[model samples]
Target: MISKLNLENILFLDIETVPETENFSDLDNTKQDLWEAKSRYQRKKDFTPDEFYDRAGIWAEFGKIICISVGYFNIEGDIRTFRVTSFYGDEIKILKDFKNLLLFHFSQTKHLLCAHNGKEFDFPYIARRMIIHNIELPYKLNLFGKKPWEVPHLDTLELWKFGDYKTYTSLKLLTNVLGIPSPKDDIDGSEVYNVYYKDNNIDRIITYCEKDTIAVAQIFLRLRGDDLLNDDEIKHI
Candidate 1:
């Protein structure tokens, strides 16, 4: 199946997000109530909304994107290098820069935005955030009326599932199964919130995001029965 698609046309991506505010206490009373309501289904009974706030980053309404790392293959003769870059900073700036990238370079209908579980998370989150920031949605990310076949989004997790909706697969597990080097050598998703909020380390988050982006691309290649890329072949820009 992967052999049918043009690898160069796919843009692999991953994002790191955090709660809009540093702490639950920072939210206005109305937002605090809203967050509590949103968390009621998922949070443990003993956990207060403030205690559960760290998980808010997974929700588009409650969180803000801090980093959006994207990668694409650059083919030159027999050499196929995967080049990665990231947009980091304030939420508005990050969204705007990413939008610019899409509009300026990857605007073609043949271009695709690929991520792990991107259909459920990264893709929609980016679209919502762009709306919040008053930035127009990039054509590739807009899927209001496009048929399933017309949507140019590729999700590695969905590809692995083969239509089984009940099972869940993490990018880490797929990488392990495919023999791709682990991207979680530093920190995982659970630690990203604290890393950004408490540690005030956006660079670290960008690094982690970039690794995940690369992992997604590698996993896609593996699905195509291709060899994993070496470190020297990964260009960071």
Candidate 2:
């Protein structure tokens, strides 16, 4: 039903993230410390709070967003095309450029932005980073004060709920169930931080991002009953 729900007003987005580190020490100063302490307590069976923070700091220092790939369906051609851009320089500048692109392309449209787990992670991350850079968020993104379900958000993960709140699904597993081809290759969620940190290869990041965007798009197509990808539509990185 979502497919017939107006493709003219949808923007598919995905983000790459590294753990928060710029103000890690500042966490010790506020109520956030309690949350951190609780998280540590929960994960105590694995690692201590200090050790976890230390390891996270190491990844934050080296883990950068190398690429952000965005895909949009071409209504005229009935084809989906994507653009994978790199952010190899300053993180601030990169975030700004990305924000600007969103503003330019999506500001005037009544578009429903969709992403996997975007409600929790990608959306807030981008909004906070934009504020840090003194950039105003675009209209569709100004949903901070709105109710989660009221907003024009189509999180595939949420849809998989199928009327059950406790039924959570991972993107990988959902794609498999839907018969969508999984693009997961040598890299995975855990390896993403390491790949970006250790190799510093933008191409690899771009590949990873493109695959994700494509997967999301395919999921949308299936929900809409539209034709999904054939061999020609796929681009392997």
Candidate 1 clashes between residue pairs 3 or more apart in a chain or in different chains: none
- Each model's lDDT comes to 0.92, 0.63
TM-score, prediction 2: 0.78
Model 1 is weakest, by summed lDDT over 10 consecutive residues, at 1-10
Question: Pick by lDDT: which candidate is best?
Answer: 1
After superposing candidate 2 on the true structure, give the runs of residues whose Cα lies further than 4 Å from its correct spot.
20-39, 50-66, 77-89, 144-150, 234-237
Native-to-model Cα distance after best TM-score fit, residue 113 in candidate 1, in Å: 0.9
Clashes of 2: 1
Off by over 4 Å in 1: none
Q: What TM-score does structure 1 among the candidates reach?
A: 0.98
Model 1 local distance difference test score: 0.92
- Tens-digit lDDT track of model 2 for 18-89: 544433454545634653664565557696554454234223222334455666654456555443343434
